[model samples]
Target chain A: MTPVARLSPDEERDLVVAAELGDHEARRRLVEACLPAIVALAGTFRRTSRIERRELVQEGIAGLLLATRRFDPSLGTPFWAYASYWVRKAMQELVADLARPVALSDRAVRVLATVRAARADHLRQHGAEPTTEELSRSTGLPQAQIERLQAAERTPHSLEERVDQDGVAVATVGERIADPQAEWAFDDVLDDIEVGEVRALTDLLDDRERLVIRQHFGLDEPAQTLRGIATGLGVTAERVRQIEAGALAKLRASLARPAVAVPNET
Target chain B: MEPQGTALRHDALVYDSGDEWVELGAAFLRRGLEAGEGGVVAHTRQGLSLMREALGADASEVRFVDVSAAYTRPVRTLASYHAVYAEQLRRTPSLRAVADVQFGPDPGEWDLWTGYEAAFNRSFSHLPAWVLCTYATGSLPEAVREGVWRTHPGVVSGGTWTRSALFEEPERLLRGSSAARRPMQVLRPLPVVDGVEQFRELLARELVAERMPSARVLDMLLATSEVFVNAEQHGGGVVSIRVGRADGRFACEIVDRGAGFDDPLAGYLAPRPGVGAGLWVARQLTWCIDFFTSADGFTARIVM
Candidate 1:
């Protein structure tokens, strides 16, 4: 058996810092150290489904990564205490997903909608609250049925589409987008773009035009208006507008013309 | 606590013939005397004699009334006599009929006692009020008993044992209390399988669909497959499996048509145990396990 050496407090902190800075080995070590805790939290929801265990573990790992990124050493609380809330919330989401189907029957949804509508109407007209019995009688449904519907109204189902083929249910989005094959196909399409066509477009734009366009649209938040773009570029709104218009015209004209076929493909 | 009434020294006894009409009448009198209140007893001469033998000297105080003579009297005269006797008894207000055999007690008292007795017997026996009433009225002939037993096998077999009777009321019995009975749901038998893999897969699918807990569902599947495997390897090739849920628990039973084992657990747990690992695993997984084996075959139940 390999004797495991325990890390000192300073060493642990350094490892966490290194992992957050994108050190693969440090990240792997951190995950190994935290796997048991994550698995235990996931096991709390074992009464739900086994598939939920793997999913919750993955979710916990994601939360752990996020916590590492956002961790503040100045905060008095330990890292585990800070990450506990995220881990619990992930597990709760898994349990909620498991309980969704039985808790949200169709009849219940309709009954709830009807009751909400009736309550709104009653508040508008009578200005007095209606009793549960009165509501049940008014709805022409039994009190028991109404109570079941009320309980069902509280739980919600996940919105992801699932396809069941040959008795195996799988998520369509996960299968399509998360697979390596799909990533390869996407890369292939990007690769097929003509390099000369791209160079011609780059040549058509000056440095200022390229920077404005890239900062405005290619980054997370697009520039809201011409003025915002000009402010970022340290230029006049008119100059920013001229650059944007010229960049757009060049791209449009290039797209309108035929693509230069790569000889290697033939 | 009310003040204690004086204890009356009295004894009334009853006997049964094939008819046993007179013994029932005497028994009614005994109950009344024991209660420190008097009541009538209507009986034939032969029944009265049997009661006399049973009670000995205590029988001496009993005022015997011949129902045969009452029947022979003119209807109008008898009716008038009955009314007068009833009124006279009310006025006297003693333990009036304790050691006596008479046609009936005072009309109001008769109605009250019979109704009270009906409620008492129903609660005591956990049988229906109608059955108690029929017994009290001496109307439960063999034919009536057979009919009732046939119609309601559960009642006949005494499944509804009344653990408490203090809270029972005549009104509740008359209203037909449904709470006294447990609700049972029946399900069709599932096809028997040779291995646990298929059963586990089915259970896993059901669990993922939120039909049941994965552990309990897996436990039931494993337990059921264990029983089936027992039947296949030892008893025969395969048997039948039936599954259902009751009282928030799942249950499955496997039944087979083959020679039974001497001791079910012993055979399963003995040396060179064949397919016993399955049974052991099932036991660990399930909450309760039971087996019934006879010369005919075996039936095992696993509750989870």
Candidate 2:
């Protein structure tokens, strides 16, 4: 590994001017001085992406060279600052091409935005988030398209942060009460088998998911707010809402139908 | 210091034949059951059947779980296994298990599986459990084969357990495995965001201009905001934020000039009170978040 050569700020600005005036040695020197920083930048990407560190370094150098020719000192930004963008951009372009599948077309992005705007409008009007069916109806998009848009945007949520609806994180009305003693009136005569079935269903969720659900419902402790759940889970209140939504969605889907259904309100 | 208990002893069992797998698995469990420790066997259907046959009446003493069913998602699997380990330990002083990991068919997915294998060491190292992960040597990719050697601390062969020289520390191995190595699309650059409001408005505008769908854009906004704010607070200061279209999805890399870290498990750990969960939130809201460190500083690349 080469010990990266450094230049004083004024000296670096001078080299940029000289290099732009077609000084080959000046340009070469500039690239050398920035090599270590570029390598270090590439190292950040090395652990997480599929692109090789060596290739990234080479790409960074290419960016630095381009910076030398195109940098305009009149803009008054540091040369390395301007050059580092090109370096990072170059590597990112390569990753975009080889690493990921076509993520979304400009058209797809537009369509999704349209659907989301419609959903937001519905939420504002109805004071609740809209379903895909409602969104499709209002947005004039096909249900399949809306569903696909939703599915494609499903991020890999950590157990503590599962976003379901348009980014709202959260729980039921009873769980929303600020006071622990303010118990809402509801039936508590569900059988042991029903309880066991719910347990089994909840078991399918990860630990944090289960924790969020339990905390929200006051299963073992007092019913808590989204903020309380977040603090307990060591996440943001917004993230807690998302996890609660996701968990409830999972539970609802599981409970909707089974050969032996739990008795509901008669 | 190590925890005061039967500390975890994780080993890899690389075998070629079905008979060898059953013989080794039954012997491993028998040795544990004889000492009154609980035994569990998580394997494919065939492996379970063979183990049951080999153990005869002893099979009734062991718990059998279909690996095909249990090993679906890496994080979920870890959580489920954690639950199982906790439950088993409550009934006995120690626990032993045969884990036949099913590394899926797609070669692209091997990294996560290998990561799971390596991560298991940190997640379960304190438990009083002995886990022998079996791998079919014939089917594994060369990279996966190397990963197996690197992730596990011990190797079990010919009914004997020996320390593996190839074993690397989990953090080091995961860092090496997590390095990005593929081609992605180009991202457009965003001007330096001066503050939180500016950052949000600029990033949202960029995504809107790119025609990113609203839900994903919302996610990207929340996720990227967290990364950018983190850079400002902890990363000395923000250098620049680069955003562009990659493979149809939007990508952003927030660069900062700070003394970068090398720990792979940084944000993955459960967050503590008063500690920031920004990285963890960013990780959850994107398709992937890859951390890069170089002499230049650090970059948190978020892809959605």
Chain B TM-score list for all models: 0.33, 0.69
Q: Distance from true position, residue B214, model 2, in Å?
A: 8.8
Give a tens-digit lDDT track for model 1, residues B113-206.
Answer: 2233223222212110111111222423443333222222122112232223233344443233212221224634666654644444443343
- lDDT tens digits by residue: candidate 1, A60-145: 66556545544433333455665555555556544553454553446446767888787677777889877667777677655544
Please give, for residues A1-266, the per-residue lDDT of candidate 2 as tens digits.
Answer: 22222666567666765544334456566665666687678767633224455556666666665555445444456677667767776676555434444366687789889988998899789999898889878987766457656755755322233334566656433234232113311112112212332233456578998787556544434556678888877899899878866764564333222111123623
The number of the candidate with the highest TM-score is 2
Please report, in order, the local distance difference test score of every candidate based on alpha carbons. 0.43, 0.64
Q: Please give the DockQ score of every candidate, comma-separated.
A: 0.01, 0.01
Ten-residue stretch with the least lDDT total in model 2 chain B = B268-277
